[model samples]
Target: MYSSHIKSVLEEKMWLFQLKYFPFYAEWMLMVLPFIWLITLPYWLPKFIVYLLEGKHLVIKMLILMTISLLTIFLIYMYVILGKPNQEKWKNVIFDQHIKRIAIKIYDATDNMIGGLVNRDVEVNRGIFYVERVPPLYWDVLKFREDKYLEFTNGSTGLVGLLSSPRAFNGIDVIGIPSAILHRRGGGSSLSQQLVKNFYGQDYFRNQTSLNKLNTLLRKYKELDEAKTFYHNLRENDGEEFKRWVAMYSPSLVSAGSVYGIESVAAMVFGKKPKDLSEFEQILLTNMYKYTHYFNGKAHENKCQKIKNGSKIDIKTYFAENPTKVEALIQDIDNWDCTDKPRVPLAFYKSMLAEDTKGQLLIGNPNSRIWDWAGTSMSILRHETEKYKIVYPNHLITEVKITIDTPKNISFKDSVNKAFQNVETKLASRLHVNLDDDAKSEKKQANIWISVVDEKGAIKYIYKRGNTHDKRRIGSISKIFEAIALGNRGDKYDYFYCNEAFQNLHNADGSMGGECQDNSQNNIYSARKVFGASKNLPMMSAFDKYVVKDNKGIHLIKNKIDDEKLQEIYESFNLSRDNNVTLKYELSFGLTNSTPYGLQKSVHKLTHLLYEKQLNYHEAHIMESLKYKIVKESKLINGGEKNSLFLKEIDSKTRKMFDKNTKIYMQTVLKSALDSKFNGTLKGFKSIDGYEPLFMKSGTTDKVVNEKKLTQSKWVAGAIKVKGKRYSLVIMVHSENGIGKKIGHHEIMKPIFKEIVEALNR
Candidate 1:
């Protein structure tokens, strides 16, 4: 009875294991059965021919049945592998269109972001792998090092070998896969298979917990199909296609704590371009293919063990006996340098591989040479996709090219950095505190945020000193949206009296006021002036008259402003995850909570719309031109097919934010706000030296306690044209401790504007 019970328990455990891994076992079984038949094919061929000559009807029937069975199994396998993975369930034909909006926004915001893989100059600038430039020895060594059993020209996955040999889906050596799985042995893969895995990500095949054997098999099959298709289509032309393949699929190397292209890796390791690398350096890089992370100048314990044990075996003998030690041996060397540098080729071919006792090697790991220069633009892309609940594949070959207008000697980063430094210096001077003094209370310190966008909708510069995404009271910048909405309602030029009765509560000192106020009391202002001058009383009167509609006698001011109009604008700008519905707005101006980024986008859109109207151009024309160029270029990259993977489709029906005539009118009104003759608040800031034709508006928010007002927020938001290009610059300064000391926008922020213009001119 005891023996029976023990037997039953063991049987149950085995059954559970089988049940859990059924798909895994079934996949392997299917492969192994074919492998057996493949091995016996030569023997069966002679007999099969004899049967055909003898006209054996039973043999023909058996062959038909076998073909039918195989076809059914193939169909089932295709269905399982080709079906969309659960991770990408959110993406479909409809939701894919929204991806275009995100892509365009990112393209605009990252217009000046430095470096990327998709640049045309990558081959010359970054030294990414090019067919002509790469040393032939690199390929010879790669063949010997990674996959020695077959010729590499059979395409990425070695599809020919896969069909001919008894190997796995990726053409892994029959003996290798079983050893690798059972004993944790490492194995080689075809180049196409490796590239496919790289497309999935670094850990897609490397991490077992994240992907089980069943999923790996499925993924491997899919990779085979993709690689075969891409290779056949692109290589048909027979010129630079291989280079393009490498450019697209190679994984990035880690350098300076970030993943970068081949040039960065080369700089980190040898301080040289790939073409300039010595033979020893080439060998070292080839060796790094096995273990990328192990090459970061860290001592590998396992590799070092063999060195410590003083093994004197030659390279061929050692490689043959201990294949696993190949990577360990290479990594444990002095700084990854070859000790026998002068005789590198001779030693590599003839003698034993050795390590250095005195460590001072410059050798580091080399990853597959793929460029990743998108920089901050990638963050915007991520935010938008996440907001829309879409899982965009990371490996899509998205391109972003910017036509920088700055001087060649001065990079975008350097110019933007200098501009911000000058602004920080100005802010420090005003606060009378050291800019580096972190101990100062946050409330007492002034925070300035600047965002610049060009007429092409590209965000050329953004202040990186503070969190631009932190939602705060946007103050009168909200009036841009209000003005556009009211313009749509044909009330843009409607005049309203700046009533003192509707003003904000004044401070005892009579310096500033809170919430709602129009200092120009009793003056009549149009909606254009209300926006350009940022007159709160006139804006409120216009908002109450034009926007706040009476329905069922229930107050709908909050819903109309916050829920309907503001939400639409926010969504149009694609402000990631901004909850406009919950925000409470008592009047038209100064209380709309928004990020500096969002405010900048709103101002940029308004100014660009005005500029386009003034130039007699339409936004739809620009969108269509951009869309056509992108789609055409994308199709070229993907071998003359509109790759479904690319987010190239954009909505053609673009709604004009404001009427063309209204925009033209607003442009003049905005310019008037910067004119001294109009008694504009920012008239003093009009003379920006070389960058003239300045149009601006100023906004201020104050808090009153015990009838004492404290200035909390101040803004100077507008556009300036330089060299026939419109650039909208939005500057916001906030203080936690009330800045009761009065300082006009002209006096406080004009210097920053001048510095920015100087940087641009430089």
Candidate 2:
């Protein structure tokens, strides 16, 4: 029993081994079957010997038979898989390789064509080009030969690139073997519908529709000339239409070349092809060239017409007529003087002086300076004196009385009260104040005073007591009158008082005289202050500080001026100076005003002397004499035959006057001994070298009037016509206003003396 059990266990182990290793051995043999069959003639072995051998050892024979059967089956499989009895394999291979080669060629050609279109050159790389029937299909990367088609199947469906020789199968014409076998063999889709959509169109396969539409249009047009003309007009009138035309025509031409190649292949097969290029092909080629030429010619013509027509209209005339339009159009052109002057708003003026007393009165000063209000009050007084002289004539005054009080008192009984009464009852009636009688009556009670003076230096009337009230009313009324006067004078004051202030300041003794009052301290402070303060400061810093500081002060004062005459002069020269020039002078003046007020006051007194002389001098006589001297000098310089002799003569006379004026001025200052030396000689002298002038006990008192004649001197003069017409009146101011240690007293007076000479000559 033990022996039987052991034998049974061995048998079970043998069966397990057989089950585990048999299949592996069979598979190994199957793998080598093709090589074995190729090398051995197993099919030719004797069948009788094989049967006899099988009967003698059935189990062994069965195993041998099974191996032989497996080998045979594998051999058959090799023949089915690797062998090519039909030309199908050759045809497929050739077609695939052909498609690959053609695709590469097409890619090279298209790349070159595109490069040419955009003016570029690029090299091509190897790849297959294919069209997919479905969207998102991808092409496979494989080694392609000359006669094989790339085939793929998705599920049960098959696809092939190109076609092999046609063959009949089951009554259906199968152009090539179904791709299912290749697909099952692991081939993949290589091209997708997306590529076609991008390169071609979504309906590219729906052939003849676009072509037919284009052809129909061409047929209806008939003549190429008419078609060209219509296309040209379409391009000119409608860009979308032109784009559509180009799209339709361009593709048709490209496809025509492809169709021609197809036709050539068809002809070789069918044997009845046309001998020459087809009419359609000819039309395609001709239209391609014709359309291109037409497009270029039309573009050239349009450009030419644009230039020619543009030239025909006189730009100068157009500008003259439609200045605003031209300005708007050429707004970006650099350095364009859009108008004769800039149109600044009253608000801008207000903003510029907003920090000063002037701005406060015009718009209300948010940051008021003490000097700003004082200077503005003074300026308004001067302006009012001049204005009343002109308008009231007999009522012109040199002195005014004003009273100041608290706001409550101002609202009650003050100079403002009397002034308001006068304004409402008399001036308001004449000036046309836009206020109701009740409002005027209410305003008349305001706590301010009014005063009047005559041109003879006599106080005509006094309605106020305090200087504070006088200054407040003067500042306020001055500002209001200035606005009214400026408005009546048109935009001239707008430019002069506001815009030209900085520029004028610059031209006036290296100060930006005419810039906006808020641009420099010179505008705010007296000229003496600007010079005094700026003496110690660097040129650049002086200018910058003055512009930032003094400008507000000047603006304050300027806003209070009511003299139309002053505004006229200011506008003519102030707003026209260069920005850089103005900035420099503004800075200089700012520095000058940074010093003590005593120094500033002293300088102003000197300036007052100069100004008084200017105003009192016999201008007509001086101008006439100057004109004569100028003429004489021109003849001496340019000869008697000169056409514009007056110009040179004027220049000569001007120079002489400047030189003489300096000499006279210096002598007067030295002789007066206003310097610290000879203390009693000029009793009121503030200093020996830099002294303030003495004042008489009374305003009308005249200290002395000593006049002296200086020696005559030759001068060079020149003039030029301004704007083809107007004459510019030029005069030089000679004083210690120039560089270096102050010039000799005689030299300082030269220019003034020269002016007197010129006036006498004229």
Please give the TM-score that candidate 2 achieves against the real structure.
0.14
Per-residue CA lDDT of model 2 for 299-324, tens digit only, reads 43453334223322222233457777
RMSD of each: 17.3, 37.8
**Which residue runs does candidate 2 get wrong by more than 4 Å?**
1-5, 33-38, 42-75, 78-127, 130-762
lDDT of each: 0.45, 0.25
TM-score leader: 1
Model 2 scores a C-alpha lDDT of 0.25
Worst 10 residues of 2 by lDDT: 620-629
TM-score of each: 0.51, 0.14
In model 1, how large is the Cα lDDT of residue 272?
62
